[model samples]
Target: MSDPLLDVENLRVSFATRTGIIEAVRGISFTLGRERLGIVGESGSGKSMTGRAILRLIRPPGRVEADHITMHGEDILAASEARMRQLRGGRVSMIMQDPKFSLNPVMTVGQQLIDSLRAHEKLARSECRQRAIAMLDEVAIRDPERVMGLYPHEVSGGMGQRIMIAMMLLPGPEILIADEPTSALDVSVQLQVLDIMDQLVKNRGMGLIFISHDLNLVAKFCDRIAVMYAGRIVECCKASELHKAQHPYTLGLLNAVPDLEHPRPRLEVLQRDPAWREALSVSARS
Candidate 1:
């Protein structure tokens, strides 16, 4: 394999609290190529924080310190605000958990997407409108022309999510960080949404950082899985081999997930140990 598309070494994020300094994301390192990488953990386990740090989206009071965050050999951590703005939706984009929260209610879906397109490149208004409609159609949204005229509230949750995907992908970003994109959608729509994302990732050959708490979903979708505990990754392995993870934390998480085919009397509760956070190790499995 060649060098990674994105590389991270000793990335950390912390916040200043009244009591003391709180380290939300400890020293964690990983690299991403043109493939899917899943960061799976419970809430407050820092999976979402890791994604935010990658994009430099962590705001004030919450600090982001990284030894290096290189994207295609350029240091993103050191990039100026202007350069960061250009890179944000143009070079690397993120699809948030819910479209309702991420999309602007005031703007029509078409206008929002057109704004993104125009931000990244110069084009005629008609051209941008055409491209926006085309992008919506690509996400499996029927009647895209009508959709282009409708407000965010007029669309269903699934449609809203697809519109957001269309907007984020219109720029043809090199890397995508999806933070539990399908969590808020219906079970039927979940697979539909995932299929759209998977197809787009494959078609674009983009590096994907999929952040989710669902071990089973990530295992099924990602090539590599990084299991995170409190503020750090405890293990890294091939998604198919997650069931055979070596770390105690990984084992506990795997045991906690309910098996649908065969029901257990009681799901196992995860027992946390203080020593698990002492040293972070990357156990890469073939």
Candidate 2:
């Protein structure tokens, strides 16, 4: 078989605090082909940090150490800044959790979209604008012309997310990392955004790393699921196999969610286990 599209190994990220070091990611490893992979865990499980580390977006006072990080045969961890720039957005794009922070408030949506296309491809102004508009339409946004002219703040949360998707798609990336892509929107709008993303990823044959805390959503959307706990992946299996997960942490997480069919007196709570932490440390070291 051919090599995976993206390969990560023994990836670790930590922040240096006054007290000591806070390990955000504890040597997790995974490989992605042209398929959807979901990273699920509660908040502070290092899901977002893992995604950010892959993109080399970790800020100062934080340290990232990895055994290997390769994308399509290229050594991403060793790439120069200029080369990394070419890879980021052009070959691998990320859609942030919130459009409010990702999009420029002052810039018109059209300008940002067009700029994204122009940065990757040398196209005529007319061609760029046309492609930008087409992308907006592809993401299920009607009246692309009017919406393109409006600033980010002028549009609804769902629309802004669609625009962000358009911009990310404009780059024709091989891998897309969506971190809590629909967390800021209503349930109705969230489904719409996810459907658009699902269609695009399928049509383009791109590998997707979907990071979310919603296990139910992950089970429905992803091919495989990785359950993270305390900065490490405690379980990795096919989405359908999640119910049979062997890890205690995974079982705890699965049990915590309420079951609609069987009404319960109270919701199940997660029980902390020190053995899980010890096992995680051993796994990281190994």
Candidate 3:
């Protein structure tokens, strides 16, 4: 009933390679309120690129053009660098796919977390450290003190993810873009991490954009699902309606997943159609 927290319209991104210009994300549109929205597709499907483009994190050699990208009532695509910096990690934060690559290897976990909080808020040293430790505890870290002093390399993958979650949540962002937040963890740990994220997002009433290749996980954790193929979204519907998806590509993806109840000799492979890609590009431009 209220205005969406985030709105993206006709978003496009492309990379200039030696061979040719490769379009990573075709013009796509979506909106998010205080609800979970899942974008699921295989690697190179432009899922991660879409998330990065929303934050305007694309670097040189890559170009991002959007008709509109707004947060609340502010125009993000038109914002100045200084304003964008203030928006990033303050009003909108992202939890990268790999904590090992994202975290500062040389710094202590507590130091990194404290720095993140201090970047957005003017707080005393003692207050920042206290808030950092409290956030770690909130993410279900058992021994916050020990974990805080330890370097990123010393902690397990699951622990690293929880720390990253704490850091992202510390700023109290209105929207969180989490790209495969639990892809590297074990099954048990994966569920635990997702549970922590789920609980925190709901508690804070923040809109979430969950990007992953796991259809089953998305169906369970998200309220709505967006199925991406090539560089565009082919189907967007409620998670429960995924089974009844009308698009051929969506159906193919669902059929490809393994069904435990009905054991099969082999999983079905996706059948690509160049025509589909061409049509999507045309539609994107229109």
Candidate 4:
């Protein structure tokens, strides 16, 4: 890849609890070019935390440490809060797992979209509205003008996700961190949402960090795959080569998925090893 869009080294996220410090992410490193990089793991494997830590969204009591986190060669770990605010939704945008919690309940879809755009760029109200509608159309929302006036609750789960994608892409960010954006939708809608995101990312030449638990979905959508286990990346490989991943944890994850064509009598139960947790994380760069 010609000069990666984002780079990180030895990134770690931890929290202080009554028992002790619980590490959510431990010394994980990766690079993202203008291509899709998928992070897949079971729940509590730090897939979401890795995304949040990249954007410095982890709050107090949750400490993020790293050798470095850089975007376009600029050190993210050293950026100030104000700079980070500029980066979020401007240079970099994040789509949360659920729009129900991420979207402002009090605001209409139009209002939220306009506000998000205005936060990143100086534009007239009419222009912002026009741009917002155009973005909504781009994401394949039907009758975007009318849809804009509707509250988030009024839209279906799939439409809500498309709206979120439109809102995030409205600012023309170079990178997008999507955390399980289609988890709430039906299988059909999930594919539609993924198609929209894939098209947008390719059209914009943007680097995408796709965080999800679906191995099949990730394999189909991403250019590269990083299999995380116990808060660390156990295997990194080309998405097309994921089935051939060597790590036991990676093989376990693949085996855990049910195949309809070659139906198994019962889904294989994932057997965990204590050593996987203690093993060093594999670098996903390049």
Best by lDDT: 4
Q: Write model 4 residue lDDT over 1-286, tens digit each, in one string.
A: 6799999899999999999999999999999999999999999999999999999999989999999998999999999999999999999999999998888888999999999999989999999999999999999999999999999889988999999999999999999999999999999999899999889888889999999999999999999999998889999999999878899988988888888899998888888889899999999987
Each candidate: RMSD: 1.4, 2.2, 2.3, 0.9
Ranking by TM-score: 4, 1, 3, 2
Score candidate 2 by TM-score against the native: 0.96
Show how many residue pairs clash in every candidate, following the order shown.
0, 0, 0, 0
Residue-wise C-alpha lDDT for candidate 1, range 129-205, written one tens digit per residue: 99999999999999999999899999999999899889988988999999999888888998998898899889989
Question: Model 3 over residues 17-69: C-alpha lDDT tens digits?
Answer: 99999998998888888989999988898999999999999998999998899
Steric clash count of candidate 1? 0
lDDT, model 1, position 174: 93
lDDT of 2 by residue, 31-115 (tens): 8888889998889989999888998999989898999999988988899989988888999999999999999999999999998
Better of 1 and 4 by TM-score: 4
Q: What ordering of candidates by lDDT runs from best to worst?
A: 4, 3, 1, 2
Which residue window of length 10 is worst by lDDT in model 3? 277-286
Clashes of 2: 0
**lDDT (C-alpha) at residue 277 in model 4:** 93
Q: Candidate 3, residue 225: CA error in Å? A: 0.5
Query: What C-alpha lDDT do the candidate models reach, one value each?
Result: 0.89, 0.88, 0.89, 0.93
Model 4 per-residue lDDT at 145: 99
What is the lDDT for 134 in model 4?
Answer: 98
TM values, all candidates = 0.97, 0.96, 0.96, 0.98
After TM-score superposition, the amount by which residue 221's alpha carbon in candidate 3 deviates from its true location, in angstroms, is 0.4
